[model samples]
Target: MRILRCLKRTPGIGIFSHNKSLIQLKAYIDSDWATCPKTRKSITGFSVYLGESLISWKSKKQQTISRSSSEVEYRALPATTCEIQWITYLLHYLHIQHQQPALLYCDNQVAIQIAHNQVFHE
Candidate 1:
């Protein structure tokens, strides 16, 4: 496969490093509106990191169709939040102190506004 060939050609490297002093969690999320031609479902993708090291990530087709791009991006929040929550609990179990709250970054402005507003919008 092309991926395997690229990996073989590239030199081995160690990039991730542990930093006990700063144990902050962050998640980046995005979604494509109506990417699937057949299902017409948006694909949600997210990556979770701990102190600059990637710890978790996923990309999958949404179970339900989203009418708007903002809706699609909004749907991604729960999954990313759940993953971050699980990681936080895991860190707590291991007695790793994470004082700062996890940050989520999304590209869509409407999605951000939707998340901020408490009132429901159809």
Candidate 2:
């Protein structure tokens, strides 16, 4: 309602890139474990940037209660990864060439280790 009206009237809000030839994808993800006292479910949030402009973002509560902070952070990774993958695929479909790998940033060290550990995959 009011938010839509504001957006319609807003200026300089759309994605603008000075250099379209060099587009990069980057993501940041985080989660807060058991932030809701009633449900005890964690909240996962992520933002995706295309070069200097933000293209996608999400913030939602986890479907299940996470036992640990690491678990909650781990849960957030898949969602962000999926989003980055989707964007990559979309770029490919649009015939846009972004050769470099997408970078994902997360604050949880334990979760990062778990993601990197080969043993966890088996």
Residue pairs in collision within model 2: none
Candidate 1 lDDT, 1-122, residue by residue in tens: 23235546875843355655368998999999999999899999999888877778899999999889989999999899998898888789869787899999999999899999999877
Off by over 4 Å in 2: 1-14
lDDT per residue, candidate 2, 1-122, as tens digits? 23235557885573477775359899999899999999999999999887877778899999998889999998899999998998898779869788789999999999999999878542
Evaluate residue 94 in candidate 1 and report its C-alpha lDDT on the 0 to 100 scale: 66
Residue 82, model 1: lDDT of 92
86 Cα displacement, candidate 1 (Å): 0.7
Candidate 2 C-alpha RMSD relative to the actual structure = 4.4
Maximum-TM-score candidate: 2
> For all the candidates, what are their Cα RMSDs to the real structure?
6.1, 4.4
